[model samples]
Target: MPPSLPSPSSVTRAAITLPILARAASTTSAGTAVTPNKPPPSKDHHVHTYSPEAFPLGYTVSSTHAGIKKKAGALDLGILVSTSDTPCSAAACMTRNVFKAAPVTVTSELLRNSNGRAKGFIINSGCANAVTGKKGLEDAWSMSNTTTSQLPPSGAQSDKEGTLVMSTGVIGQHLPISSILDKIPELIRTLDDSPKSWLDLSKAFMTTDTFPKLRAKTFKIGDRLIRMAGIDKGAGMIAPNMGPPQPPHATLLGVIATDAAIKPEDLQNALNYAVDRSFNNITVDGDMSTNDTILCLANGAAGSAEHGGRETEEKMKELTEKANPEEFGIFKEQLREFAEELAQLVVRDGEGATKFVTIRVKGAPTYEIANAVAKSVANSSLFKTAMYGEDANWGRILCAVGYTPLSPNPISPTSVSVSFLPPAASSNTTPLRLLTNGEPEPNIDEARASEILKEEDLEIEIDLGDGNEEAKVWTCDFSHEYVTINGSAEEEEGWMYD
Candidate 1:
């Protein structure tokens, strides 16, 4: 199920209350240092805000010294190192695309080698360590090892902690590790006990992403407040995957940190549950990445919830979900909700997306089937371009289904039925061959169709007419802007390709 929107309380006041909370939280911790040219609250849904008190896991972030994609700059790298060996857990869902990136491959190995034990996180934006083969792997491993070595030795200094690393931006390029190494010292100096630092870290991960993405949660155990913070990077090429096709399952790259006092195993379980409900539930491109990673680290700095403080528990429950009796399920639910919201923001800012569209597929044999059909519609360039042109071309939607993996190979030429809701983008004055079995009349008024296409949100559903599989995928319409964003580097600065 597409997870029903949280109780109206969670989102209803989010717009208004969230801002007050962010302001109050910011002023209390870091004073009133405002950012410039900040857009008014009502203008864009592409960015959201939260309180810092929600993440107290003592974080130290530094940038990548290597600089730009092809040039050297100041502070483009970052690290999220924990001060303690706090127990942590995570769950991720990556791209199904076969050409996985080097960073994704190495990070998967590290996570598997450590068995959920992640110490710190390393990330670079200018280059995506992909398609470089052995040398790329070498670069990824070397970067991981360097990050591992920088941590304050464990033994007596701190308990045991694991590390996760991520890279984003144009694919098929090598990272400038030397520049990153040199800048590490200076980047480290900027780290203070402030939330803005982590926000800066999130911003540094952007490639074509227009804004920093982040989410935080705070829960009170007994007399203490436990906090978790996360950062993600994705503005394009997103999709759903079945994961490894077997075994321990699949994962994604979503970095989350918490300052809760919980056992490592417990944290892992919580993280898994959270990801399943959150990141795993979304799809943007139907084209998975080779470098999708999400790692969570914990440093028991805030201490766990005391078992007896009823007062503290109630107060914490107001903002943070409770974890006892498992009744406090709201914590992970809210996190997933916020994360989905963040992911949508990425799509709204999708390189050239002037409008964000949501494709909902229901009434199928299973969620998987619905998802398959959804992706077919979401990823089809025909469907996308039609969307871009504001043309209600149901034929394109039907064409997408015909090519989808779900389409019966031998081409069942029959046994399938499809339909579109009223105001569909079709110009057939007469009811055409819209229904194969028990489907709607395949005809729509051109005027109504055009009006429907003008709306910002879109919903498309398909009934395989098979059993009852259900799936839903999300994507933006293909526009000339998308083309422009994907063009050569020079075109990115100015000039257009005629």
Candidate 2:
């Protein structure tokens, strides 16, 4: 079972009292006024910031502080809206964790009720609405209803037209629904489709993250240009297992918006394919969050006939049968590439991470075996620490691969080989072979191997010598600072509630 929330009596009283305290401070007598004690600043905000270069067409983003976070002027609430004339097509990948947050539950129901269509998303930081049970669900519904109420009426409103909600930060706390609802009008009025708005929205979603993650790309499909922009927030508890929207359980929240108008099924297929190679292949702390969500909204505002139009049904059918190399291949590849870039940025900005590492496994009998082997090596603490210390400990790498239990087809240690390469910037460097056929290579240069490990980025390649299938996993070296950041997180937030 998930963690239990605070006792109802104490929680209810605190919740009812906080708003009264804020209001009391403004009350004044004829001659004098009384001042209420102010809460301490939140320790959650860090120095890292970001600036976005471009934003997707037909989308506007904005953020504001709603007192969920104690820090003054910190952006704790945000919303992203699609401004197309018609409803936008949507695709989502959610976490598979059993204990889902309120927002995750609400979003999943909304998507199913609407048949994969939505107009906007509302996100909040500093209070993750998990473990609050029935009341949490009610609060999440209130958030969506308030947002929809504030928007201009377009025809009739249904669950499908409701905005998606996402929350991050401290777990097991009830959201300050009153404060959040009060800010809906201001948040709606400030929405803009400018680059700065996107950047601010990205920053508003951050928690333990040291920096914002944002990426944008434009692809041409026959004379018309379609643009996609994405922003994500994760620095801890960052392993993600996002899949189709049915049983949502991933925590690293990401939002991708595009101007291409594609069928919902086709968009969902593309999102799952991209996630398998990108988000699913990276690990920060090897722990998954209960609120992981990746959503993509395509508004088709680019006026591109080739991408989406009256013939969308036929084009989607053709894509399902077999991608047309000349037509669909370019768009598919661009989407995958953009997702991969964003995934890499997540690792690069990992909390206290100093070295970015890539683990590649080849020659496996199946893609599943290849992925298992790569992740085992990438998530091993001994290997990560060895990299942080600049130690060329190839034995640790080999040990991790040897323990990956491959069912049906057992791996033979005698058929495995390992090699490490220097950073790409070093043109004169050569890859150092550590093992051949499971034995240490003769006359190996330990000095050169150690030199390669000193670079900020490195790659380790492993060959199972079983078949031709391959997989790649991205990770970062573990450092002392990582422990320090996590060790103090709970203490920092604990003071706020007290």
Best by lDDT: 2
| Angstrom error at residue 232, model 1 | 1.6
lDDT scores of the candidates, listed in order: 0.55, 0.75
| lDDT (tens digit, per residue) of candidate 1 on 1-498 | 123212223323332321110110113255653322212122244445765555665566766446645444534588876654333433333444577777767666665665555667778776777677888888877777766665666432323334566777556566666766665556555655466777777777776666677767666544665676777776665543423211212112457676554444444455555554345545544456666665656555664355321113222222223336343354455445545655555555555564466665555666666666666677777677666666554655655555556423222324555443432443433222334553335343455455555556555556565565565455676666565656655311322110
Summed over model 1, clashes come to 45
Q: Please, what is the TM-score per model? A: 0.70, 0.83
Among all windows of 10 consecutive residues in model 1, the one with the lowest summed lDDT is: 17-26
Q: How far is candidate 1 from the true structure (C-alpha RMSD, Å)?
A: 13.7
lDDT of 1 at 361: 57
Position 1, candidate 1: lDDT: 16
**Relative to the unseen true structure, what is the C-alpha lDDT of residue 115 in candidate 1, on a scale of 0 to 100?**
56
Clashing pairs in 2: 95-248, 95-249, 95-250, 96-249, 97-249, 250-292, 251-291, 251-292
What would the per-residue lDDT of candidate 2 be over residues 432-474, giving only the tens digit for each residue? Answer: 8887886678767766776787677899999999899999999
